[model samples]
Target: MQSTISYLWHTDDLLGQGATASVYKARNKKSGEVVAVKVFNTASYMRPREVQGPGRQKVLVMEYCSSGSLLSVLESPEHAFGLPEDEFLVVLHCVVAGMNHLRENGIVHRDIKPGNIMRLVGEEGQSIYKLTDFGAARELDDDEKFVSVYGTEEYLHPDMYERAVLRKPQQKAFGVTVDLWSIGVTLYHAATGSLPFIPFGGPRRNKEIMYRITTEKPAGAIAGTQKRENGPLEWSYTLPITCQLSVGLQSQLVPILANILEVEQAKCWGFDQFFAETSDILQRVVVHVFSLSQAVLHHVYIHAHNTIAIFLEAVYEQTSVAPRHQEYLFEGHPCVLEPSLSAQHIAHTTASSPLTLFSMASETPKGLTFRDPALDIPKFVPKVDLQGDYNTAKGMLGAGYQSLRLARTLLDGQELMLRGLHWVVEVLQTTCRRTLEVTRMALLFLSSSLGTDRFSHVAGRPEIKELKEASELRSRLRTLAEVLSRCSQNITETQKSLSGLSSELLKNRDQVHEDRSIRQIQCCLDKMYLIYKQFKKSRIRPGLGYNEEQIHKLDKVNFSHLAKRLLQVFQEERVQNYQAALVMHGQRMRMVHETRNHLRLVGCSVAACNTEAQGAQESLSKILDWLSHQLLQDMTKGVQTSPPPTDPYPNPEPTDLVLHMQELCKEMKVLALDLQDNNHVIERLSRVPTAPDV
Candidate 1:
């Protein structure tokens, strides 16, 4: 009897019993259609196979069939194939149609035997055969091997029985011909009412069946012969339809079957192709379409960002405004105007207010719009006609907004670039450190070896030989190491200098924005006017009397103060120069000491290896000449230029003071002359050190 379980089809009654599994009839709660749900015995049956292997885990779900198993149908006296032509044709067509659907969807009903097929009886009691028992069904391409012989003995393929069930790792290709062969066997069985390759009621007849399928010729040679003769034919003893199909239509089957019965154990066709051929109804539903949408969004962002950057560049150039590193706001500062007397316009006429007050303060307004309390900006500035070119202003503002967006993007890109640079520099530093350590080790080994006294035993005292070789190669190694070290240092210093320069660029930008020199000049002009007004009020004529004398006295006082300030400035400048000189002197001394030490080491090393007297003498002479010209000349010149101290220690003659004065005067005169000549010499020097083209 059929039973209901929520919305699913189920059975209250058991349909069949087996050693491994049990089948029951079920009814759909909504449609009341019958279905068979098979419950597998967990201990007896192996698990559902994985793509890699098999275990006992799979259960079958089926549909109820009133006509029972194909085996039972053939065994009954009335239904057994003493073969009525129409009945045979109908059964063959039903089997072929179901198999075709499975194959097209890339599913393999690997076990296609009589016991597995069931015939559904309609309300009118007419039987419609359908393939069921999907428990043994597997994806055709699954690599996992199911070890057990799964179906009735007669339908097993010869190759499947003989060969390993699991495909080898190297086998990438498979076709649907294996399933077709099983269908052929099923067709032959239905017509003959006997298992094709095996007989029943024999002693363990499965082994004989396996042998026939594997090695012996199939009993139905006539079937094969008839199929070859007909071009393409079905196995039905009575069928009007032809079995021939186009190659393209046939090619579509493998992937189709692979989809539905997709034994996940195998390489199954993806859902994309499965749904496409499921039916015309399901073809409209698309899966996994978001990938295309994301690509489109990515493209739009890049294009919009680029357009914004170009617009910003154009605006910055046309307006003669340097691109601001920080955000810009036009509404932060507002303009004010200086008061004008005898003005017909701009003055507010109030009967209660004094005309003189209006005349006095008419030059500037007390307040205006768009002022920040944090910043001290001028009350007045020259204003532009912002609304005059509304269209142009609109265009420029649009461009400016674009620039702001692009600037943000650039900031992010710059951060990434800086991070990349940091990583690269870190790697370079690591490499340099390793190289230095290796060179140090090599040098230590060389030094120890070259100190050897051995003469003939080179191989036994290889360390000594190595040392001698190292001594010979020391100059080349030192030169190469120094060159590389200098290059690395230069790269580091260049990066540091670039960082400093970038900071300077920002500083310059701030300075340009904050410049109020023009406003300061106007303030000064106003102050001068105030002084003039005071002078006029006092009736102080500059050309006559006490007023002129007082003014002249004030002017002299200002001049004396200015001169004193100038002297103070000069004193400060001299102090700074002295400190700078001391720094330079100390640096130079250290450099000289290091150079001398390096030279002494090299000289002693060469002397130790001086087997040739003439070569040693020539090297010494060249070294002496280089030291004399380059080092001594610069040192002596620096010493000569330094002045004597001002502190007096001994009772000296006034003549000493006189001589000191004379020396100072003479040196000043020579300094002036040198200064006159230095410009031309510097120009010549600049032109002389031209880099050679590579």
Candidate 2:
């Protein structure tokens, strides 16, 4: 038998069980790899007659998670305090990500609860939660109605409950919104360590809980007291006061719960709406801290409109340091803390390490330099201009321009500004890459929405043309991202090389002419730095600032004209079924863009190294050639003249010559390697796709 087939998998240690399947801990004997095996119970009548082997059994194998389920953690007495706000949000984020994935694939996981959420321990000891149990999962076809009433009772949507209670021959079908409702319930349970509407005690407790879920409002939603919205329903349930959640969090949570748990399916929160709301709330409610000193640290509960002035006040309250005295440095440069500037705006601008804040009051320089905070904010906030001409296509164009500008900055001869520019580029590249993924997802969603009959009114030839254009733009932007990523990597390698050379030069300061090489390399690095700064000033800062302002303005302008145009398009009858093609094209573009950028920066440092190598090669060649001539002269003298007691070329002895030759050889080898590396870098740069003209 094959090793895979012969490998004994021990499945006796049971982990957990549900109505449909039993999970057991197992280990592969051959590989010693641990796994979880879930065996589904199949009735004799349901078993397929064609399945004659062990494969006939309904079983699924998956990776084992040591931390177990979220339900287990919540129920455990050790975790009575429940998860911290950050940890809880992380869990919710993971679940949301999974749900988003499911929704994208046109599948609905009817059961989304704490028990179904498993935590996997990473190598760093950090826990990553994953959604499991697809037993109640179903794929919905276009125009197909979902009518099944299968799911956990406590977590079921009010719509589902109504359908179940009515017992009609045919009821209104549920959509992907039901899954979101389940998530809301799961989040509530995770946060409070107890179900929201489920009542305790009484003979018919299950029925009562169902009734409360279907009919009653959330306890937090009541105007004055933690009671039902309509009237005080007689139930033996006590709200868990142990949650100790912040007012800001509670405010966000209440509305989210209300939206999800709405009785009308039409009123229920969609995936996109839920994601945006939750993401915003999570960002605001979270307290981010900046460690000024070991003894002095400042923390602020972030809000949408939090300004630099507010942050400084929070810090001053913590450390008794005034705003003027509190100089914030990020990556060794002073951070601008403008009173009118919003924290979110700064975050978008400084994509590198936006949260990182270093106080430089004690070690302040003679003249404190303050950067304009407005310079950092993007001119176009895409979210704000949702209904404008500055759509996804325009956004990509802007991103591409920024990337190209960054690449140009790296190559520019600005030694003093390179360091800061390099830092900015690194941050920008990371942020852009992440944003690209989100853009891809959005494109997918847009394609899906436009393809269906729901948008048939506007799905005309012009709209199809626009969609196609967007797809192509997305492709171009992805390519630009790749190029930028590769360029960033190359820059890193070049920096490392420069650092090594600098260190070597520092150690050999007394060596003849070594000081000159050191100065040259330093000059080269300075130029690179200057180039980076110029890039930031000319490209990054202006682009971001302009974009932010434009977006802000567009956001404020009533997009009534744009809305009218869309409405007009929708009314047109010449619309084509081009959505499917557009979607496929987008998917293909996404796949292609996954390829990493191979563009490399041909820095002045590489050029300096090449010059140094050439000089060394020439010098080495002369020394070797001179040594050969001396040896040849000595051999001729021995043959023609009487042998002298003293050796020829004795001022620098033969032993010394050999040692010098060895040293020269070593120097030449180092030079050769440097030249080879430079060649490789140049080759990479040559292969980079040319940037589109701005």
Q: How accurate locally, in lDDT, is each candidate?
A: 0.37, 0.48
Q: Estimate candidate 2's alpha-carbon lDDT, on a 0 to 1 scale.
A: 0.48
lDDT of 1 by residue, 244-304 (tens): 2212222233234323322222333443343345332211111110001000000000112
- In model 1, where do residues sit more than 4 Å from their true spots? 1-12, 28-33, 51-59, 80-82, 123-125, 141-149, 163-175, 199-203, 206-210, 218-694
Q: What is the lDDT of residue 141 in candidate 2?
A: 39
Give model 2's TM-score versus the native structure.
0.40
The true-versus-predicted C-alpha distance at residue 491 of model 1, in Å, is 99
